[model samples]
Every structure is written in C-alpha cells, then in structure tokens.
Target: MTEMRLTPLQYMERVAAHFGTAPHAVFVSTFGCQQNEADSERLCGMAHAMGYADAATEEEADLILINTCAIREHAELKVLSYLGTLKALKEKKPALLVGVCGCMPAQGHRVEQLKKSYPYVSFTLDPASLDKLPEVICTLLEGGRRRFVTGEENPPIAEGLPCARRVRHKAWVSIMYGCNNFCSYCIVPYVRGRERSRASGDILREVETLVADGCHDITLLGQNVNSYRGDCDFAALMEKIACLPGDFRLRFMTSHPKDVSDRLISVMAEHGDKIAPHFHLPLQSGSNDILARMNRRYTRERYLTTVGKLRAAMPHIALSTDIIVGFPGETEEDFNATLQVIEHVEFDMIYSFLYSPRKGTPAATMEAQVDAAARAARMERLLAVQNDIALRLATPYVDRTVRVLADARGKQEGILAGRTDTNRLVYFAAPEEMIGQFAYVKITRAEPFALRGELINPK
Candidate 1:
C-alpha cells in the first residue's frame, strides 16, 4: 500500500484537533523590514488555523515564534538579545513551544549556534521552510526531537497561504520572492534565495480581493520590484493594478537602479495619481569605485539619471533613499561624493546606515574596512546634511491640502495618525472611527519628521 501524503492544511487540522477544547495562545515577535511584517501576518494566520489564539504578550503564550532578520549586524544583535530575555519566560512555562524562523536561521552557522546554545528553541525554519510550519508543529506535538530546517539557496515560490493582516486598510502583496542580485555587501540573496516571481494572475487576484475588501492602500513587495518578471513586466503589472476599479493608492519599493526602465517611468507617470508619488530608491554610495567594489552594476551617474527621469515625469514626486555611510575601501573623497549626491538629489527622506559586515559576504573580508569611530562620524555628518534637506523640502507643505489615509491612532489622545500619498506622516485630531478611512487634511504646521494637520471636513 502507498503511504498517504497530508498537506499543510491537513497538518493544521491535526494540530487544531490536538488542542481540542483547550485554549492555546501564540506570541509572535517580528523583527526587521516590511517583508518580515507581511510574513508575520501569515504566521499568525497559520497559528490561528492551528487553534492558537493570539496572545497579547509573551507571558501568556503557550508558543512563541520569533521572526528574525539577518540584513545587518544590528538587527541580528537585537534578535539575539530578545531571545535571551525569552529564556526566563520559557523557564516559567516548561512546555512552551519556542521557534525561530526567517533569514537568521537560514544560515548554517546561526542554526548550529541555536542548536548548541539555545536548546529551548524547539525548531527553526527559513523563509522557504515557512509552509512546513504546521508539519513541524505536529511533529513537536508528538514529542519528537528538535528540528532545524535550512532552506535551499534558491527555493520555489509558495502561494495562497492565509494571511491574518494586522492592518484593516493596508496590505502588502509580495509580487515576487528572493533576489538574483548578489551585491557584495548584501546577505539577502544568500539567505532568502534566488529571484522567483509569482504568476501575474495570482498577483492580480490578490490585489482585486484586497480592493474589494475595503483595502485603501496596497504595496507590491519584492526584493527588486522593478525586476519582476511575470506574465507581464513590472510596469505592465502596475498598469493593470492601477486600472482596477478601486479608490486605493499603489506603491512598491527597494527598486534596483539598474532595472528601472523607460516603460516603468512612463507607466508610473500615467498612473501618477493612482500610484503614490513616492519612490524609495537606494543609492548605497555615490563613489564609482565603491559601487564597483559593491557590484551594484549601476554607476552614480546612472542613479542620478533615473532620479532625474522620475522627477521630470512627476514634478512633485517625493524621493527617499537608502544610504550606507561607510563601505570597504571608502575614502574621504568617496564619502564626499556621497554627500554631494545627497545634495544634488535633495531626497525627501534618507534611511542612513553605518556599514555592518556579514560573515558570508565579500565586503566582510575586503581590505581597508572603515573603523567604528569613522563610520559613526560619517553617519552623524550624513544625517546632519539630510536633516537640513528634509526640513527645507517639508516646510513648503505647511499650507497645502493633501489626501491622507488615517492609518493609526496618534501618540497623544484625541489624535489620529495618517500618511499622505507622498508618504508624509500627518497627525490630526479625529475620531477613532476615522481609522482605516481616507480624508482631506490641511497642513497647519510642519515638523522635521512629520506634519500637523486638521481634518478638512470632519464627519
């Protein structure tokens, strides 16, 4: 007789039945990017399907899952520190199931360290092994040994997993997974695997459902969104979504300069109103020598040209960028060139980072590694420069009226927080009911990091 094969859903049912009438709770600790947040939603959804209630805090949880990031040393350190804190909780709850997944565990060294040092961690799964979560849970329920699942360098794309979205009006639809660009300074390709795009139909259906369900903001996510190759190209895919019948704003991120095409720019211009007028293009460094060493493949001039085209097409486009303060073989001239580019671009926002070496990446072993003090000094200067640019650019919007989505409750009482189409944070006084809805706001004041606004027509 042939052996039976059960799917993830069946495994979910098995776990749910194992819990029967008793209540179980799961606490999910997610660290890192927007992509990680999306993955957590799915994690929560799966846990629910397995009959685990969402625990408000770790103390109340029967199971704890830590979704980690391995992009930089800082994030990894944070995750490690967090895990140590969980040890006390695990000690108190002897039977608590603890799992760590995502990029960090995908690395062999990290997995071995967890196995040796963190025995309380019942299992570890990489992004590729995410779908096997229920099966792992079932095995644990049977009192099996510890499990460590290292995902393949290049794995197949998994689709149709249930996601318990934390936000009611905002959604992140991962259009593609993994990356092909092996940037010398990047660990993404190593941990997350090679690039693989979802079918165009799958993406369209997901967007359609979100729009039908009152989703007001949808972001298409990818390692390099512009490099998406589905039934349609990235530009064509955006056009299709933009044309969908909905009152929603579309956005994407982390575009590779080398992949930004003329068609993409044209499509964005055509759907400028439907698509948010904000682009997050990362310019790691402005020095050609540094870029060459980093294997970015696009020169400083090319990045500027792309930025020029984006602005030319949409005059009011808000440009944000990622900048690494120091890189291997960087000199004062290279750093100055970066500052010069920042000045030339006058980016609305800059996500600046001090370079952190990852063991497996080429940049880790390169000569002339920037000193910690030098990196810190350069980061300070970079922020000072960008702060001035940001203030100057933000001040002009003080008297402007803009559309904003009331996404969250503000830090203060009687306040609602929202973001404008250009991705500017706006705070206004409004009812809690206003959350998940859109409204017109008249900016009364502008701060360095946000704008103070009032609802135009309070309802």
Candidate 2:
C-alpha cells in the first residue's frame, strides 16, 4: 500500500472529476461511541470542503463512507453487514466510491480481512489520520487499487475545520484523541492508542467558536476524558470552559474511576448549574476480584467512595454507567455483586452488554468461558433489574419544573424536544421559534427513558 498526500483543494478536484460534478453527493454512516460520532463529523467537514454535498439518500450518493467501530465483535459484524449492502450499490455504479475508516482499520488483522473480503472498499484510513482523508480520497480517485493509512505518528491538530453538524444547538468537541488504559477485557487501548490531550488553547478556541455560532450545548469528547491533561489537566479545562462567555451548557463522558479526582469533582460542583449534572463512569465489574482481573485499578469500595464524593459535592447529580456482564470465569457470586451495585447506585441510565471476547485481547485467550445461553439469561436479568431502578430514579422528576434547551421539533403536534440539565430527554409543547432557546418546562409525565413536559415561559 502506497502512502499519498494531497492538499485539500487538490483532493476536492480529483473527487469532483471522478464523479463528473462539482458538488458530489456523499453519505456517511457512523457507528460506536461519541468519539466515533465526532470523527464522522470531521470526516463530513472534510468532504464538504472538497466540494462534496451531503446526500439525501444512499441511493443518490456518489461516495459513501462507513465510519466503523471494533470495540466488540457484534459491532464489527454490524459494520461488515452494512458493507455488504453497499457492495451491490458499488456493482451497479462502478464509479461509486466506498470507504471504511476508523478503529477497524487501525488493527492490522482487521484491515487485511477487509481487503480480502470487501474488495468494493476503496480505502481504509484510521481515525487518528483524519487529516490525511483528502489525500486518501485523492489516491482512490486516481485509480489506486487498495491502501491502508495508519501510523504511530500524531497528525497535526487541524483547527478551524469546517463541519456539517448533525444538530444545531448541541456540538461535540474532541478535546483529545486515543486512550492509555489497557483494561484486560478491552481493545480500545490497542486501537485508539495512548492518551494524547489536545492543547488547551485549541479546545477553548473551538468552544468559543461554537458558542458564537449559536451552539448552546457542548460535550467534551475523549476516550478517557478525566485523564485529559492539556495545559492544566481535566479540572482546569473544565473550569476554563465553564467560565467561557455564553448561555451555553457543558458536559463530558466515559470517566475512568481511577483518574477522577477531588479537584475535578470540586470543579463540577462550582459549575453544577452550567455543567449538565450527569456523569457516565464505567464500572465494568463490581467484585474486587473481577475488577483486579479486568485491571480497572479501582475496587468496588473505591468506586462507591468516589460516587459518594460526587453526590456530596453535587447533591442533585444524575449518574449513568456502563457494565459488562459475564466476563471470562465470572461466577454466580460475581454476577450477583454486579446486580448489587446496580441496586445500590440506582443509575439514571445503564448501558449494559454481555461480554464478547475480542480476538487480540487477553480475555479472549483465557481458559474460562461462560456459556452463551447463560450469558444471555444473565444479561436479560441485569437489564430488567436496572430498568426498574432507572424508572424509580426518574419518577420523582415528574411534576417538577426543569430547564430545557429546545433543540428540535418533535413528532407530535406543536411539540419540541430538548435535554434537561441532567441530560434527561424532555419532550414539550412549544412553538417552532423556541427551537434553539432555553425555556422552563413543567414536567407532566415521566417514563423509564424519557420525560414529558410543557413550556412555562422564556428565560
């Protein structure tokens, strides 16, 4: 595979010539986490800069990109299945270009497999090499058969990159890239590489620009956001972003329990009103034995203590978490311990998954393996228990007055949808003009997953 580089304009010219049009239509399908979503946005921005217009439908798109994820076996399979559909499209229109980019390509074996199986895919580019996308597209346009673009080198942190945002009021700001923590059951560290925080000045400038552009909410994205040590570290970054001039709100996710510090909690408390009162801390296992096996670096007791500290700092904070069920050698006692933690924490939301072994990870080669049927049963039971808790936690908010930033029009008549300060989805009846503004909403209904409210008055 030959590596190629081209300027943005030259890349656009090649694409336009290949498609026989100035504004070529492009469609992107993104999978996995928020980090992937942010990468997709940047990819779209690059395409837009290259004279490619957003396609209304896949059938109409001249170029289609599958921004993939390889966090789990199922996610990878889903991406491949999607690629199968695009195969027929490529056959019909030989000029139609298809590309696969993101974590899947970052892994050597997966890239080889993709090349062998999906010949319709024109190129494979890693997420970290986003700046090289124009060059990769240009190579494909120039009749390059196949190529894989990835390396250990950090690409330039290109600022002022144009983006076609999926939403108007909410924006995702990638403050950093990659992860350093190599948990035993995980593959993120291998795929995303080590933690590399963006400079504070770049992050602050991006946020300020979004604020000026009428973005009222921003989520600082990173693999392990709490580990972000820009100029001053995660705490300092939060303080600086919170103090920025705007009527905007701030939030972040996927905090490693080990990296979260008292100083960060204090910063959250100080800006509790401005910061969305939500935290998505991953607690993979509840048993200390399993925690150690998983290399989480924090025991169940330590995690609870950190939760306690956050609650004490911001009494009204809502908690969400990710839990992996049925890891290698997980006994009945270990599963029960996870259930107990769910009951105790009463998370606002829980992203639960049955552990699927990823081939290069340590857990895959471990001798112990839980039965598939048993894993499915355990996952169902865990979801049932967690859903009940989520409903209970959400019920109290019914009939309470909460502030919501109306982000979009709703499906129902004269309805609008937005998220609460705690990141709760709130649907309310409001006029269209109120779509990008904040308004007080009086909660009238509550569900396990969403809340219903009515607009009270403009702020």
Q: How would you encode candidate 2's per-residue C-alpha lDDT over 181-291 as one tens digit per residue?
A: 889888888887887888999899888988998999999998889889788899999999999988899999778999899999999999876788888899988888888
After aligning candidate 1 to the native by TM-score, how far in Å is the CA of 318 from where it should be? 0.6
After superposition, the stretches of candidate 1 with alpha carbons farther than 4 Å from their true spots are 1-4
What TM-score fits each model?
0.97, 0.93
Candidate 1 local lDDT, 308-425, one digit each (tens): 9999999999999989878988999999999999999999989888888988999999999999999999999998998899889889998889999999999999999999999999
- Best candidate per lDDT, number? 1
Best by TM-score: 1
lDDT of 1 at 252: 95
* Stretches of model 2 off by over 4 angstroms after superposition: 1-21, 409-411
RMSD of each: 1.8, 2.3
